[model samples]
Target: MTSVDITEARKTDAPATPVIEAKDLTRHFKVGRGFSRQMLHAVDDVNFSIGHQEIVALAGESGSGKSTIARLLAGVYKPTGGEIFYQGRAMSTFKSRKDQLAYRGDVPMVFQDPFSSLNPAFRVSHGILRSLKLHRPEFSRPQREEEAARVIETVGLTPAGDIMHRYPYELSGGQRQRIGFAQALAHKPKLILADEPVSMLDVSIRIGLLNLMAELRRSEGVSFLYITHDIASARYVADRLMIMYAGHIVESGPAESVLANPKHPYTDLLLGAVPDPRAPLAEGIEGDTGEPPKVIDPTPGCRFRWRCPLAIDRCHVETPLPRRLGENHEAACHVAEPDPGFRE
Candidate 1:
């Protein structure tokens, strides 16, 4: 649907408390052959929350562990260490069949590649119908078909009659993505883990999908954890922004505040890279030339030390704890001075 229609669908209600919380979550993988096995710290001591109907963007470059965190939240991978709570209940305790089934219904995911998630052997409607039957078995055949069509229309694929019959290979990338959204919506989920949902689509189609997600949050009260590498898109769609580097969250806060006055050197480097017509081409952060540290058996100190322009002796010896920079704003940097503009 159009942006105007999506905005008009918003609800007027007070914000709700967090529906998902990750406390000191860590996930490590073993790399290399059996004799030379080494730990690859994919997600290290990361913590964050997603409130009801909120959209939190996780932004970082490739290999920064953004996708790893998303997988952990979606319950695709049990964290090697730490815990995940859904609506205040521990996810690890969901060992019973009934509990696992309930949790799956409550949390659905939209993958990065729409083609990979769909079945080429069946029509698009069959996938949505299958999800409906699995999640809402009470519905009869007619009800299931009606619900599927309604959701497909909700994602802005007009005249569901025409689109439902098309196979995955018959549709374009954008059409397949809309079907992905339809499939996720079929579950009537409380939250969605969107792993780079727009990174694979044409640039022109990205904004429309983002708008549809915002519409879902507004009208259906569905929360979203948007994982992406593009800082500009994150700023546009997120209520909160978390910046990750080498598996650690170095900075996080409300989107506008963090983007306006970035406290971490890595965050500044990322923001500077975004093309801005107002700024001259010469304006950019220097000393960001070195390669990111290998995640295998990483050092104890700050992971960004080798490339930070403001690195000091202490940064190489001790890891910096997350320090408060402003209201709801925190950064992990030994030398990041609190901006006077944010002082009480």
Candidate 2:
């Protein structure tokens, strides 16, 4: 993704409603031994909404629960707590497998590694044709072929017929990635959740792919939930941003505001980690130095207190919920709240 942060664009239409809404969404895994055995809070009380035609980027360090949340959204893992709604209807309310299938038709996912996502045994055309059949089984075989060619072309593959016949190993990384994008679009899904969609591609092709996603949002009114660790890239593709740390959202707001004036200590650390050509490069944000704390029967206090430079006694004793700090901005930090010294 591009590093440049353009000014935020205002929406002219009625604020588009969320196509995906996750309220207090959570996922816990049971691990460890006797007495230590406890629930690993992989995703902890996460809440956010991705509106129609909007792109909401989830930025965080690895193990901050971005991937876990994405899996939950994709129905690969059911949440342990909270609820997920697609277009305001509870996901659980879908009674039959057919209803569940219909609900999923509205949302599709694009994985990080295009090479792995496509089948090695199938040719590019076969891979895409299968996806089209699954996503819209009603489409006739000829219609499916036309749709596959159209989507492949939309993602910038030239002479779709030639590329479609090539096997996965035969295409360049960018071309394989374009095929992945084509698979997602074949269904004309209303929401797309991309997990580090361009991280594995060569730098030369990164911008082109990001620009393609941006163009799709602008032209087709497709909603996106883009997950990435690169703060610089997030600024380029996101409409609003949410910064997550230790399985919790530390700060969230318009991309410009959060990038320009980060409110939380953790968020500051993240932004400061971005590479800067003009500014002297200091020690970047450190990676996870120790194994994640046992998620099972975890401590009740702030999960980030051990690494937080601003931690106080209170931070070690109680978990702080989100506190609003500005218009469309919120932070889950005691220091950023009205009474920074109230921790005593």
Could you tell me the TM-score of candidate 2? 0.90
| Whole-model Cα lDDT of every candidate shown, in order | 0.88, 0.81
Best by lDDT: 1
Encode model 1's per-residue lDDT on 195-314: one tens digit a residue: 999999999989988998888887777989999989988877788899999999999988888999899999998997888899887876687876676689887889999889899999
Regions more than 4 Å wrong, model 2: 1-16, 33-36, 278-296, 337-344
Q: Where does model 1 exceed 4 Å of error?
A: 1-16, 277-285, 341-344
- Lowest summed lDDT across 10 adjacent residues in model 1 is found at 5-14
Number of backbone clashes in candidate 2? 2
Q: Mind giving the per-residue lDDT tens digits that candidate 2 earns over 72-181?
A: 88888889999999888888787798877766666778999987988998888886788778768989999998988998898889898888888999998888988888
Pairs with backbone N, CA or C atoms under 3 Å apart (clashes), candidate 2 = 38-296, 39-296
Residue 269 in model 2: lDDT: 74
Question: RMSD of each candidate?
Answer: 2.4, 3.6
